[model samples]
Target chain A: MSAALHRIDTLAPRAEASGTHIAIAGLTKTYKTRGGSVPSLKPIDLNISKGEFVAIVGPSGCGKSTLLKLVAGLLPATTGTITIGGVKVTQPPDGVGMVFQSPVLLPWRTVRDNVLLQVEMRGRPVAAYREAAARLLHTAGLDGFEERFPWELSGGMQQRAAICRALVHDPEVLLMDEPFGALDAMTREKMNAELQRIWYETRKTVLLITHSIPEAVFLADRVVVMSSRPGSIEAVYDIDLPRPRDLSVMGEGRFVRYTQEIRKHFFAQGDLDH
Target chain B: MTDTLLVQSTRANVLSKLMSMDAIRPLILVAVILVGWDLAVRLLRIPPYLIPAPTLVIEQVIAQWPMLLRETMPTLTATLGGFALSALVGIPLAMLIASSKTVESYLYPLLVFSQSVPKIAVAPLFVVWFGFGVLPKIISAFLLGVFPVVVSTVLAFKSVDKEMIDLARSMRAGGLRTFIRIRLPHALPGIFSGLKVAITLAVVGAVVGEFVGSNSGIGYVLQVANGNFDLPLMFAALFVLSMMGVILFMALDAIEHFLIPWHASRRPDPNSGT
Candidate 1:
């Protein structure tokens, strides 16, 4: 069992050598309220290449989620451009899937129906995706439970279903915003391992927003650290971790070093105590 | 053991459990109320014409069963018809109001003003305009039933989790698709609550219209019985109307159970074992 759990392979960084797949140039966001204009995200430029896993870590109230939303085109950038796969995003773009902090499943829908929601929302015939939905559910370890409601499942299971719903449409990029924030500590660690396996299999470009430094270092090939309020990228660290990462990897020296390095930024800003 | 025998034993166990004190408490209370009412009438020596005993009312109901059933049909039809009409009209209006602030601003005040006007007072005006027919009763019932549906539906649509909406938008789902797949299903429990309230109000609205001006219906019979000082017959009509309300409410409750058993409200309590 230990040998099987420790089976590992290197994740060759394909995106680093290739040209960018998602390019952001001087992106900014500001809210215009009655009082005045409040800047949310400062002008920033970043690029993510195809089949890469990138995680953005920041303090609470930072614009990490705002950046993800801008890239997904759920919210418009205040100034510059977000181009995905050579197409500039003016509105919600195609070939992108999103998983939120909450599972957000419709209570009326069964697990299979929730997964098929992607096809239904795209105006496609749901019957065509029945097999695909079943496959995704099986991959998520939710097989034989497709007819169950969201409320019938545990929190981790619900989040797994949410991930299946996002990926059922075969999108090129997956954007996740604190997807495991609601889980217990033990479940969160288990989910991180599960997510690593899914990422290795699917190889979809991913941009995840999270607050946990260790989580960012564990899942992401590149960790983009952001500062709070009027958020901007402070630094980017490239992770040299192996693929098929297990919970045991979190105990290694390099892993601690990476997490400590990210923690220093928050500690310096006096935000860590909170 | 045979599977059928095992199933039979389990079913019998469930039936016995249902007859336990917790399950039959409401029935016990109802019995006490009935006994008290009968004793009060006997002790006060109230004239039968003023306030007949429960036994007298029951006897009157059996003797006048044919007339009562005939009159009941019109009231039941009007009540159900008005409630259905409200659901059809009000839900769409709610969607419109939820979709745009301009529409909500224009319609909300008008809705509040209409609700503020006592429906009983409006019943006479409906009779004046539509004449002494079922149309006036239906209109009156509609007026009373629509408000709850509209208000609750709007609240339900607005209460949808923002993250759910964001997830849908990120997938490039169009507005209509989002509404059908996400918003409408999410709003169902709230809509059913409104429908439950509206259905009971519809019963009252139909009866009010009949009282104002009508040639048929139990409400009209009630007015005639009151004039002739036939207390038992009036009580019989009142009993039928209450039963209709209870029946409609239970029907909606059953539908809610079937449709959204995943909802927190429908989930069996862990401690209760039901």
Candidate 2:
């Protein structure tokens, strides 16, 4: 397995020069529940390039999230290895950031103070990051709401603040697990565009997990589809499209075709046309 | 949408609210209570020793101001001293328990046991151990006050959202950083609740110690007054005790407000704030 992964590492020098950020080799995960040890993700290998926005999509209960967690080091990989920035991930990397599906901002903290939390926790001076945090908040369209508590904001606004918090630390890798899944459809689309813009502006590598086929097609440079329960990589589809894509692109034929192709792999080989 | 009408209506609403803020209902209720008390005292002619009239208690309080102040000093000292000690010890212990499950499990039952013991009954032991000096009263106050602090600190510590901790970890925050930045701030309200309850109990505990054995304090005055059948003086001492409790509690509350201006409990009601 090491020899096989070494071949991939040999490919890494060429890719590294071209900016490859994370490389996963035969990554597998299992959970030791009360009943028994249950496998979550089957052994699978994949690589996410630097500055790339990749989305993992599958049905509910699929291990797409598990894959993200494994890479994030929230959980340990049972029988495989994950490398970020050419280093094996044994724990949550210092340069990795995560955004959950829920806007998990501390309710007691004001919006600005909440963003500064990451910096403060890192023992970094808040003075150094204060302007940067403010800038990020403004980028998320939360300019004047810095002093507002989480409860004072609407759901969409709170989630936006959460995103700002994730980016405030300026991590090399951003792991997002259905960050906009809880938002309304209109807000979700808006948030998606905002996220894309942020990703483009920051040029940070992002690994987003979602169950939405269209969402995957819209945001990802490549869409990695997984099978349900005991999940493994079914296929990886490269979304060959232009940068800074508009929401109107979804109405175009190419977008629909990519979404259809991804959906076909997500469902079992059956009446996929239906 | 019309500017003039909107401004006029808003102003009218504010004016109407202000007008209704008069304490008519509360004043009437106080008046009715006083009348009922006076009527009950006059008709039933209950012993002044058992249930002294409000008038007599007030007169006693005014006349015995010099003696009361002399008593107030010692009692207030023990209450404040014990409360301060509890805050210092209990908060850190709460932090320790909150940070570790092992600490919580081991100490939680002991904390419960500490509160379960009848505080008044244990006052004599404090006197025996510490002598009939201020030490016993202070220890009594400390014992009573510490429980609320521990309970509150534990509650505050536990109430910190798991998501926030994860957020901090993903941001590369170390354990100490997480506590200072996230957990401690999250636990403030609960800690304050404990502090408030502890302050009130501190007075009770101090008095209990005085009751058992003391050369000074309002509790000693009460005992002496009771022996001589000086009902009015006893009532005055009791009134002073109640006033001291109120004053201490308010002082703590004020400190809380000053320290954590953003606390929800500290925020005045928007509708009621004049």
Candidate 3:
């Protein structure tokens, strides 16, 4: 590690080593569309540990993305509080990085420039993060593509670029909304493996929102399952798997067993308690 | 291997041949138009004073170059100057409108209503209000051009993927940062579309202003030509006006290509791959 990076790493209050990276308390979000006021997400509470890879999984339209958005402060909470690394998030909080399913890269910018977008917006000198960004891109297997445009790359390659862009600022927390949902099965699996490697390397707190049970099992230290629309957490499971997990591990009994367990919970019926 | 090389060369030759072949139909269309116009003038024995031949129109355009420039300058100034103003005012307004539903609700309907009224019919009113010379012409052109830009810009800003904004927020980007980094780039294509539509309309608006109450300009020249029954000069001025619109639109298209070459729509062809 460079002396400057070492200094930055120590100088900034350790976001991950702190007790919690993100804390959502009594969170609720309502949407007032022309159709009517639709409560997108009901009251919910979640706490994610520092440096942990947590995956939130639910059925489509069940508000997993909304939950993540609320945590990111992209959507204002109708009535609740969200704190990230000890800071209250009324608006978007700094030191948080994000990645989306579709890459969403600026078509005009080259890969390097796209990655530098965070710095540009923050009005930070690119020089401060250029080396770190280059290293992240290399780790993401995107070394030769710095000059390429998003359209020139494959779907997987663009997603890797998006991840690099998200992490270029060396953020404290990373929020991902089905970042690999658009890729083919094979590419998605490869990306899961790559993401695991990146998580191990950076130790940045990651909150991934995905619908795929297997993906959640493969990448996360903890899997958070949410209920249907007007969503809330149904269950949370600790993976207890070893790091540097191989693709072959995906075929192993332990991985399959965990995935099946999560799938069962996701589809389990709710009794008419009300 | 040798056979493969020969086949590839043959494919290249065939591709070039196909491109040239594609031009044939458009070329034929242009030839037919010219021949039809020439024949119609000759066979009908149309008086040059009423409907000049194509050759006479060209000759008059060239011979009256000084007069054309003198007449064209004011109109061009109004069209271009008003276009610049509209872009400046409309883009920021659209951004503001796009950012808030309340702004859009209040302003968008007003904008639509303003644009619905016939600009030509309102040109005399502008002349009455702003007076003749350049102010009325510029104001009329601005009024006509600004609407398309504002509408397209609003749509463009609205059309940005919500996921992208969430991604930025997850990365801890503030509203201004998100706007500058993500939303602005996404809105460029839309803004350019509006600009192109507005630019063409600007010329018509300038002419309308001139027609209503102008001491000088190509519209005034056209009026004089019509009054004197000089069809050649009228045809000449009309041709020049159309050329101006074409040139302006082409210029904007070129700018779009240069600025956002990675846009899928901007990609030339899969065959070129450049």
Off by over 4 Å in 2: A1-19, A124-131, A264-274, B1-32, B267-274
TM-score of each: 0.91, 0.86, 0.83
lDDT of 3 by residue, B74-174 (tens): 99999998898889999999988988999889998988898899888888888789887798898888998999999899999999876677666555567
Instruction: Supply the DockQ value of model 2.
Output: 0.46
Query: Which segments of candidate 3 are over 4 A away from where they belong?
Result: A1-47, A76-89, A229-232, A270-274, B1-29, B43-50, B125-132, B258-262, B271-274
Better by DockQ, candidate 3 or 1: 1
Instruction: Arrange candidates by TM-score, descending.
Output: 1, 2, 3
| DockQ of candidate 1 relative to the true structure | 0.70
Give one digit per residue, the lDDT tens place, for model 1 in B59-132. 99899999999999999989998998999999899989988999999999999998999988878888789998
Instruction: Report the C-alpha lDDT of model 1 over A65-114, residue by residue, as the tens digit.
Output: 88998998888888999999999999888898889999989888899998
Docking class of 2: acceptable
lDDT of 2 by residue, A103-222 (tens): 998877899998887788777888999999999999999989999888788888998898888888789898999998888889889888888999989988999998778888899887
Q: What are the chain A TM-scores of the candidates, in order?
A: 0.93, 0.91, 0.90
Q: Which candidate gets the maximum lDDT versus the true structure?
A: 1
| lDDT over C-alpha atoms for residue A66 of model 1 | 89
